[model samples]
Target: MQPSKLRKRIGGEDDDGRHARFLQIGVPRGVLRCRRGPMDSANDSVEKKHRKVLSDLAWAMHKLPPKTYSLSVEDGAQDAFCDWAEAYWEKADQPTTKPLLAALYNKLPDHATKLSGTLHLVNEYDPDNSDQWHPSKTIPLSVIRLALAIIDCLVVEAERFHANTDDLEAQAIARFKELPPVEWTWDKFKAKCKDPIRKEGSKLWTNVVTAMRDAGIGEVTKSKPLTFRRHTDVDGHRKMSA
Candidate 1:
């Protein structure tokens, strides 16, 4: 008896140019055959698994500290951590929930310590506030600072781990680093405005300078030197302006 021909389904048609179908070889003795499925389910399953692993790895790396180390989170760890963070934030502001708040508060100091200055900003600005203060309008400058620190730490960690973080995350880290630390003193503020090396013309600087001017600190000006500098002599010595 001749061996049965192995036929494959291709483009809704069979190898022999007819609609796909199962083939059977029969002999007076015995024979058997089977048809292939319309889709490659096994390949699809493998691809899905690969994507899940990559996503989990990326999330885990993002939560890690920016230091050289071999650490990994278990499957579903990211989801669990997020759920816990949500629950913690939900109870943070309730006066009666002191115990719960205490537990979560303890965790933050360690995480904050591990983060860089920028990532700490993100953590502080994490909008899931349980307080009366609105996150949109009243988040503290310290919180913003901490949240930015946290983001910076995460990006550095991602690179250290060779995790595939998105471009947006990397860009955020870059932008945060570009921001200069706030200068509350009039002299420091004026120096910042005039510093060509610091890119002080950014929108962040513009907004901050505007706010200070509105509060009567002194407006930014190109026509004349900064108020703090107007009193300085041409030789870079301090003198009262006439």
Candidate 2:
């Protein structure tokens, strides 16, 4: 169910300088509703809820087609970031040990401003050099909530990969869709299309392939003409061959 691995074909080949372009999507807040459960302790319940929402979001991204979006480096870094953030806060003796990201989904603050306030402390977070977070810790909302500083990093980095990705794709697909139908093997389609399809934007091949797939262009198979032959045998009986 975890689809982060599913990005391999489209977003996986990050080795040769071709990194994934993280697509920016606004997940509906309604979709993020928490699944209710019994709480063991104070902050433990908060973390449990947050973790569930994270899982749902990850699943949503996974259920999308391989061509739907590209992976960002920040996609899977949530846990480490939270732990590291908490470790940093620990030394400072902040009123609460629970990272802001550890907040319940409904209570989780704005993604931007809350993160900006504490990012300067990320370097100080080394678990080997610091104490770790425990599941049973009690954190009340009354304390100053200095949250998951790294998720701010994720959302911030998330901003980088989406420079007109959607617009460019819509344009490319619109252009390709207008072309006259032809014998549309991939190579043939490329030869017929220009720029985005032919050369310019080949780095995102899925977009190009998607255009063709959705546009419904391809060669149709035709039946060959049937032929029959007759030969006389020595017994004077005729037999037909196809």
Candidate 3:
């Protein structure tokens, strides 16, 4: 049976859930039995062996959260994976041309680095710009990885949805539009958090913002300002002048 079909039959959450059960069942016994000819059964056995090996490899990589383990961007390994994918496409000799992949591989890192530097430069000149501008350098490697995974998921999903290149590009633009505005200063970001519009129901955006804040992209203020007002006594009453 296909992995998906097996999961459905076992009434699990997803393929990973089913695989977890398979692991518990023990590797040797978890080997899939096929109701087919000897040759087919042998092939199935070989495939099962490889699958078990992969499962062991995944376990050795550390116990990641379901989100991370999921074949999705929430895993936070998207950026590195994207780098690997670009290299894979360059090396792999598939029948179809991968010009788009080539273009992305060439453009993304340079674009990210340039945009990050520009935002940093602008921050030094104008505090206002610094508040709303998030440079790409502030993005964590894990988060970038997750973002890349999400991108991959969207592409695969688009193919499943019978979407064309234009549709895919449009979707990418839409996703980018949804990302939170970048802020170079913590104080500026804190001000943003106080804005009624920003504080509204955006959990993921809030989390990313918080992560950036934690990473020192946005630092919290520590000390109160000292007052230097002059105090004058008039008719036995002390009055403070700003």
Candidate 4:
């Protein structure tokens, strides 16, 4: 009887080697004739397993939403990654599978750092209020710092202009990083923060001015009590006209 195609391809003229391979392995010669070579079967299986592992990791990343009060989505995502790594690390053969799982695990620390900073800002500032002036739920802390720096410049300019915040916004925006131009106003400033950062800024500004007065840093211009007006922008903005 003629040898099968797989056997002929591998064994070729080495008929002795072919019989030795066929007999050495317990798989019947008939079975070798009926099935694909072992190498081909193994390659296909590895490919399928590699794809499944990738798909599972992608799904886990997708499930992690933004963190919120009483819900640490960042923590949840970290746990998911840990679970995936533990489950697949032992089974991961470098042959067909990429080390993408390990790469993502490495990025976990960076993600945690940002989440921790945002949570601290939120908890410290808007402990009760839920408004746009709060730390943004979606915006990164770096961006928030940019906004705060811009505001500080504005306040400094406002003070320079004898507490008149009227037209100082445009000048401040021009000097700082150019965000898409919005009509400059105190209300607009509040809107930028989303709630947390703004609340914290307000608290800190008030506290500092009060502390300064207590320490007699600035003179009390208005009432009999040692009180200093932190803000002086007129109109609907948090302006205290002494």
Clashes of each: 21, 2, 8, 9
Question: Model 4 reaches what TM-score against the true structure?
Answer: 0.15
Candidate 3, residues 1-242: lDDT per residue as tens digits? 53334434545233333222121111121237867645677888999987875565444323422221222244444456556567645643444634333333344443334333333333333333433433332434444444455445544442322213223333322332233533223333334343433333243233333333333333323323211111122221234579
Off by over 4 Å in 2: 1-23, 26-162, 183-187, 193-205, 208-242
Off by over 4 Å in 1: 1-94, 109-242
- Report the C-alpha lDDT of model 2 over 95-154, residue by residue, as the tens digit: 542222122121223342234322322322333332341111222221113344444445
The lDDT for every candidate, in the order shown, is 0.37, 0.37, 0.37, 0.37
Alpha-carbon error at 45 in model 4, in Å? 58
Q: Ten consecutive residues with minimal summed lDDT in candidate 2?
A: 225-234
Per-residue lDDT for 86-185 in model 1, tens only? 5545655567644422344335433533343333333333223323222222233344344435543543442322221222233322332343433233
Look at candidate 3 and give me any clashing residue pairs: 68-75, 77-145, 78-145, 78-146, 79-145, 132-182, 133-182, 134-182
RMSD of each: 30.9, 21.5, 28.8, 34.7
Model 4: weakest 10-residue lDDT segment is 22-31
Report how far residue 133 has shifted in candidate 3, in Å: 8.0
lDDT score for candidate 1 against the true structure = 0.37
- TM-score (all chains, Cα) for each model: 0.16, 0.27, 0.21, 0.15
